[model samples]
Each structure stands twice: as structure tokens, then as C-alpha cells.
Target: MDLFTLTVVNAFIALVATGVLAMQGQADRQFRYQRYFLLAGGCMLLNAGISAIHFSGILLPYWLIPALTNSLSVGASLALAAGIHRHLQKPGKRFGLLLVFILLFVLHLTEFARSDINHRFLISIPVVLLLNLWCISMLWQHRKTELGKVYLAFIATFAFNILQFVFRTTFMVLEQHQIIQTSIAPVVHNVGFFALTAFAILVFCCIILLSHSQQRQMLQQLSERDALTGLLNRRTLELRLNAEFSRCQRNNSTLCLLLLDADYFKQINDKLGHATGDLAVQHIAKIADQQLRDYDLLFRYGGEEFLLCLPDTDLPAALQIAERLRLAINSAPLFTPQPYFLTVSIGVASSKDSQSWQTLLQQADQALYLAKHQGRNQVQSYQPTAAVSR
Candidate 1:
């Protein structure tokens, strides 16, 4: 299609994108990046509107049209980059992006930029290319995170836009040097505009998908995690425990469970208030988390109890870990109204001595009873004879 037709189509697309993004931003106010994307869509719409007006033979100033359109185009690109940075929770190059727009606007005002279309293309397209590259780099760096794989679509879209810009730049250079036929120039320019419109659609779709995916993941985590301690909840325990149990059964490896309970948690709540009681639980949880290995799974098993699943760990090693956790909690001071130190009683049980995870959990619970029965601040290992005797 011709330039006017392409400009009209682009304007319509930008208008739709701006409206959709505005609704999305309003609906999901928590997604801060959506605001930046809304700004980008608005800028693109303005840019497309100006281009349509310029091509429609509306009488506008010689330099004013190009200046406005180029500045808005560059602003849209910068907004896209800013949104990506925000999505990744990275610091944005705000001052630098502003400087780039300032420089581009100044260049557009110059007689050099207004005198030739090629000069304008050379001035503005490279700025956009660099911004696109910056966005790709930011997304690439974070491509391994939980939501990183979803960014592949975004990266591919930006990469395609980069190539499209390069292609346009090449055509503009060849035309500037009088290497390409005049008849072919409009075709290349229209192709560039078409590519740009397609890119705008693809990138915004990717953003919407990413936002939904992130929201879904957050909801899933909230469902499976303890609200207070931020550890795995009992709801997730059975699934994880069964998996670990089967793995150990097949490999003949050991899987140990350390059932931990905060000592005198009720007293802290009754005397210092439930708020401090909550703090006490949090304190013990924090200490246990710090003392454990990365592969170990910690869960908030009860009001003031935590369960640690240590795969491939023997009973002796589990006991040592349990003792270390007990000591760590005993030493840590919780700032209460009165002077008080938090402690935990840990019960260790190994899968090697049990037929199933249920039996193992029972063994750990019985051992926990023994530790509390003996006194509140010690680690105890499950012994079959001792448990039977109890």
C-alpha cells in the first residue's frame, strides 16, 4: 500500500493499542510497568496521528511536523525501554533517556535535519535502534528468572524490530547516495511503516501475556506459601514429602525430617501479646532458614512449628543439623517487653528407618514429644525402642 494508506492503518492500530493498554493499566494498578506501557502507547498514537496528518496534505509548518513526529517516536521507544526496566525491577536510565530525546529534538530543529529526509532518518532511527538494543539487553540479563522464559517472545519481537530498522536505514542510505531507483523508495518506506505497525501489535500482546503470567504465578505462590512466615505451607507438604519419599525409596538414599517447635510460644503471646508471639515465631523461622542448606525444604507445619526435609541425609547428620538449629535459636534474642531468648526443640527422623512418609512423620512427632518431655531446648532423634517405651 501507499504511504497515506499505511499511515492511516498505523494510526488506527496505535489508537486501539493505547485504549487497550489504558484499560489494562487501570484494571491492574499493582502492575507498575503497565503505566509505562500506557505512556508508550499514547506516544505511539500521537506519532502516528501526526504522520497521518502530514501525509494527508494538511498544511503544517516545514520543520514543526518532522520535529514533533520524531520526538514522539523516540519518546515511545524510550518509554518501552523504561517499562522493561520497571518490569524487571531494575533502575531505569531516566536521565540518559531524557538527554537522548533532548539531543534528538535539537537535531530535528536544525536546518540539516529539515533539509533532507535521509538526514532525519539517520538522526532518529539510530536512537531507536540503540533503545531497542538496551531493552533486549535488560530482558536477556533476566531471562533465567521464574518469569524469564516468558520474555522470549518479547526478545524475539525486539530483535525483529531491530532488523527492520537496519533494513530501513540501509535503504535510506542507498537512496541518499542515489544508489536506489526513485520508483523503489516509496515501497521501502511503506514496508518499514508496515513492519513498525506489526511490531507494535506483537510487543503489546507480549506485555499483556507477561503481566497475566506474573499475576498467575503470584497467586499460585500465595496459595502454597504460609502467609506469616513466607515458608511452604502444610498444603504443599504432602506433595513434596511423597516425591522425596519415592526418590529415596528408589535410590536407597536417606531422607531426614527435622520437626521443630518454638518453645513457650504461648507464653510469649500471652505475656507480650500475640504480636510479639508472631515475632517470636518469625525469629525462629528466620534462624532455621539461615542454618539450613539450599536443597533442604522448610515448611511452616503448624502455628509455631516448622518441618525441614533433608534429602540424602542420614540420621546422624540430621541430628547434627537439628542441634545446630536449636543452638542458633537459643542464642538469638527477640526484643520483647522483657528480656527473653527464643529456643526450639527439634526432632529428627530418617526415611531409612520407616516404611512410608506417614510413619516417618509419626516418628518425628514422637521424637518431638520426647524432646519437649525431657525439656524444651534440646534436639532428639527417634529411636524405635525409646518411642515404643514412651
Candidate 2:
């Protein structure tokens, strides 16, 4: 296609992308990255519009067109980088990136207008190259996750764009040296230009896919998590316990279970109101989370109660962990409407003594009962003969 046609096509695509992304952002407020996507689309639209007007022999100042177009291109690139960061759930410093882009665009715009097309390409190259490289690095860091796998498309696209820029630079140099005498030597005539357009379309599709994936994840979390504490709910606990139980039995590996309940939780709810009571429950979940190892699984079994699954742990080790959890809860006072101290009674049971997870849970519950009976804020272990309070 000719330059005018390509520019118009690009402008149409950019406008379409902007509309799609804006609608997506409106539909799903959780994926804030869609806003950056919209920003990128808008910038690309502006860039294409300005390019078309300049190419149409409009009576604008010769320098002004390329300057605005290139600045918008830089803005689009930076917005893409910011979008990728937010998509990965990473902290994106948009203000800092915007500041840097503004400085670089100002520095490049004047010189870019005065210089030839090759110099303009050179000036724009580093800005885009650096931004694309930054995005590639961010995606690479999260390569192990499911979302990261989707990011590979982004990597390929950016890398292709960067490689295309490199080739365009070389072609520009050859043209400058009069090594090749061809009319179609500019970037608009290159194969890479079309490829970049195709990749831009692919990126929009990928962002839609990313949003779908995140939405599915959110739904899964809602189904499996406790609404108040944001810990695994009882349904999730049952599934995990069954899986862990089978695995332990097959491998002859030890596993431990602990059932913990917040002491005087009902009293707190009655005296301090449900709002403070909710905070107290959240506090227990937080403390328990901090005390456990990465391999340990913590679940909110029900209201004011939690269940923990510790793989490869024996009775003695489980007891120690339970005691540590109890003490940790006792040490930190929860911030309610008023400061209030909280305690938890924990029960420990090991897979070595029980044939099945149900048996283990039953034993743990019994031990938990004993701990609550023998004054709260204690860890108790299950004995086959009787519950032993520790």
C-alpha cells in the first residue's frame, strides 16, 4: 500500500483499538491496565493522524508534523510499557516514566525536525528500544506463571519491532552512503512496517485474552476463598486435604494437621460489634499466615476457626509450630475500635498416627477441644488414648 493508504489504515486501526479498550475498561474495573491500553491507542491514533496530514501536503509548518508524531509515538511506547507492568500485577511508576518520556521527546523533537529522516529514525530508535527492552525484562521475570506464558507474545512482538528498527537504521545508513539506489528505501516501504501493524493487532487480542484469564482467576478465588479473611475456604480445605492425604500415604511421607480457633471470639463480637470482630478474625489469619512456612497450607475452615496442613511434618515438629502460632497471636494485639489482645487455641495431629485425613481432622478437633477446655491460648496434641493439652 502507498504511504497515504497505510497511514489511513493505521489511523483506523488505532481508533478501533481505542474504542475496544475503552469499552473493556468500562466493563471491567479490576483490570486497570486497560486504561493504559486506551492511552496507547489514543497516542497511536494521534501519530497516524498527524502523519497523514503531513503527507497530504497540508500547509502546516514542515517541522511541526514529525515532531508531534514522534512525540506521540514515544508516548504510545511508554504507555505500552506501563500497561505490561500493571498487567503483571507489578507496581508501575507511570509518573516517572512519563517524566522521562517528556524530557527525551523535548530533546529529540527539535533536532529530529532539523535533521534528515535517518537522523529522525536514530533519535526515535533509542527511546523505543529502551522502552521495549524494559517491557521484555518485566515479562521475562514472570516467565514461570500462566500469565507470563501469555506475555511471550508481547516479548516476540517487541523484539520484532526492535529488530525491525535496527534493520531500518542499517537501510537508512546504506541510503545515506548511496550504497543502494532505490526509491522505496524509507521505513514506510519496509516489510517490518506491515509486520509491526500486524503485531499491534495481535497485542490487542492478547490484552483481551489477558483480561479473560484474570477474570477467571478472580472467579476461582471467590469460589475457593473465605470472603472475610481471604484465606482458603472449607471447600478448598477438603480438596487440598484429600490430595495431600493421598500423596502422603502413597509416598509414606509424614503430614500434620492443626485446627485453630480464636479464643473469646464470640465475646468480642458481642461487646465490640461485628466490625471489630471481623478485624479480629482478619488479624488471626494474618498472624497465622506470617508464622507458616511456604509449604504450609492455611485455610479459614469456618468463622473464627482455621485449619493448617503441614506436609512432611511429624508430631513433635507440628507441636512446636502450633505453640509458635499460639504465642505469635498472643504477642500481637489486634487494632479494633479499641486495642484488644487476642489468643488462639491450636490442636496438632500427625498423619503418622492416622490412616486417613478424616481421622486426622477428628483427632485434631478433639485436641483443639482439650486446649479450649484447659484455658485458652494453648497448643494441644492428640493422643490415641486421650487428648493431651500442651
Highest lDDT against the true fold, candidate: 1
TM-score of each: 0.91, 0.90
Candidate 2 residues lying further than 4 Å off, grouped into runs, are 89-92, 109-113, 181-190, 247-252, 335-339, 387-390
What are the RMSDs of all candidates, in order?
Answer: 2.4, 2.9
Best of the candidates, TM-score: 1
Q: Give residue 248's error in model 1 in angstroms.
A: 4.9
**Clash list (residue pairs), candidate 1:** none
lDDT of each: 0.88, 0.84
Instruction: List model 2 lDDT by residue over 1-390, tens digit each.
Output: 677777877889888988988998999997788898889889888888887776776766644567667778888888999888887778646788788667756765575546777676766778889999999999888877867767887788788878877877687788789888767675436465576577678778777877888888899989998889888999888789999999989888999999999988899999989998888889999999999999899999878999999998888998999998898999898876567889889988999888889999999999899888889789988878884555
Roughly what TM-score does model 2 have, to 2 decimal places? 0.90
Q: Taking the tens digit of each residue's C-alpha lDDT, what string does model 1 give over 1-390?
A: 777778889889989989988988888899988888888898888888888888888987855588878888888898898888888888646667768778888999998998888889879988898889888898899889888877878889999999998998888788778898978887788788889999999988988889889899999999999999999999999999999999999999999999999888888888889999888888888888999999899999999999999999999899999998888888878888665898888888999889999999999998898898898799998888884345
RMSD in Å for model 1: 2.4
Measured with C-alpha atoms, the lDDT of residue 353 in candidate 1 is 86
Q: Model 2 residue 145 lDDT?
A: 81
